[model samples]
Target: MATIYESKTTEIKPFTYRTLLITPDENSEFSIKHSRQQPKHTKKVVLLNLVGRTSTDDIDSYESLEQANLFPLAHHIDNDKQEYEQYSKGLVQHFLFLIELQRLWKSEYDELIDLPRSSRGKFSFRKSDKDTHQYREAQIKALLEPIDPSQAIARTTATEYIGVVVKFYSFQIRNGYKFNKTPFEYEVVSIQYQGDSTSIGAYLGKDVHIKDLRLNLGKSRGNEGGALSSSHKNLNPITNREWQAVRNIPTNTSQVIKNVAG
Candidate 1:
């Protein structure tokens, strides 16, 4: 349990890991109220560096960590083969997903009951199949729930992209949903949408998995995936989910501080 200190005039709240990911129920769903994934009076998320897994275990509490903004990311992909297999095979895209991370304000943690997990940027709750009803309904709601920039309680020291590669080589969007009105079979890479938002050494790390989609390790969609570590293959014994990336691999330390400046 976190210790709460009550003062006279103002509530002097002691900070904890739990404080960052908490959000309300109304803001949980994909609503038209917010244009971007800004903290709209509900969610307050801080990009974490998993102490045992990715980040260095030096500070014990969140307060100590706030004092020392620097956190360590593990360099699991040291070998050229590992890097080639991961990057060339498109496993790099898996590690680095879309920008919109889920705020646990309106949800529960699946694995870590206490700690919250961040959602990938691309996956959306607003799944549409050319339905007119959905579009009409969204427009009606938009009037009442315009994406109010004022409502977006952007934390002064907050981050946008949670699925950041410990160290990234490319920031430019290599792929897109449609190129000259033609759609590609593979996923188009969506890098930092807002210019100069996410930096290299800014975020903390977390374990993530593709919930619905199972993409090939290779970039182009051929047989690009390679052998998993002896321990990580067939993690569940029922399905062929390669749990090695999150389970075994270590995130590399990123020396980069500046992101794509617009």
Candidate 2:
């Protein structure tokens, strides 16, 4: 069901931040060994919240995701320019564990318009959007399956997240690490889903150095920094694997695909 949006005095748009997800060891001290992705420092993190519980109806909900996208899903390896043509496929894609942003926006696309009054975008939600977003992340178990590929290069692909026009912001890796490069944040502005590029596109004008955003958000660590909001208040951030609620997902993760279709 649609979430009722009663215009609030404080309009909060989602903001991206770089964070690390680290788990504590038996000693109760943060250790690199206690992680999923097992980054040398910490795993990348993102902000996600449960939508609700899932039931059999989620299958239909998954099928319904296509209607939300402006793109069709796939394109030839070779396609022409017009540069603007990339977004034709539609927004939603072959997502096993994907779902709409329970807390992200719709009007974010209007940022280019420069309206006098600022407001949060109207997010697209399925009638079952709430029920769908829930527990579905369990599919990450499927998403994390070991790919046969030995080495991987992390890069942004256009076919992913088509309907959002993002404003880029830059930040560097936390202090020092094995690798060092600035990561940029993409703020969704409009839903004119377009072609993908490693770069952010030249809409800002000529001479703009377009950089492809290849990054992921990570879970937050306590003592590492920041306090949790009231919701996660009692939850101990230092506890090992505290963030991981669903453990030991099936090797055959069809459940995830069947569940989190969007």
Top lDDT hit: 2
Model 1 over residues 219-249: C-alpha lDDT tens digits? 2222212333233223245234444333444
The best candidate by TM-score is 2
lDDT of 2 by residue, 54-112 (tens): 34323221122222221111121112112222232211121212333323344344667
Whole-structure CA lDDT of model 2 = 0.27
Work out the TM-score per prediction.
0.15, 0.18
Candidate 1 off by > 4 Å: 1-101, 105-172, 175-262
- Candidate 1 vs. truth: CA RMSD? 26.7
User: What range of 10 consecutive residues in model 1 has the weakest lDDT sum?
Assistant: 4-13
Error of 2 at 259 (Å): 32
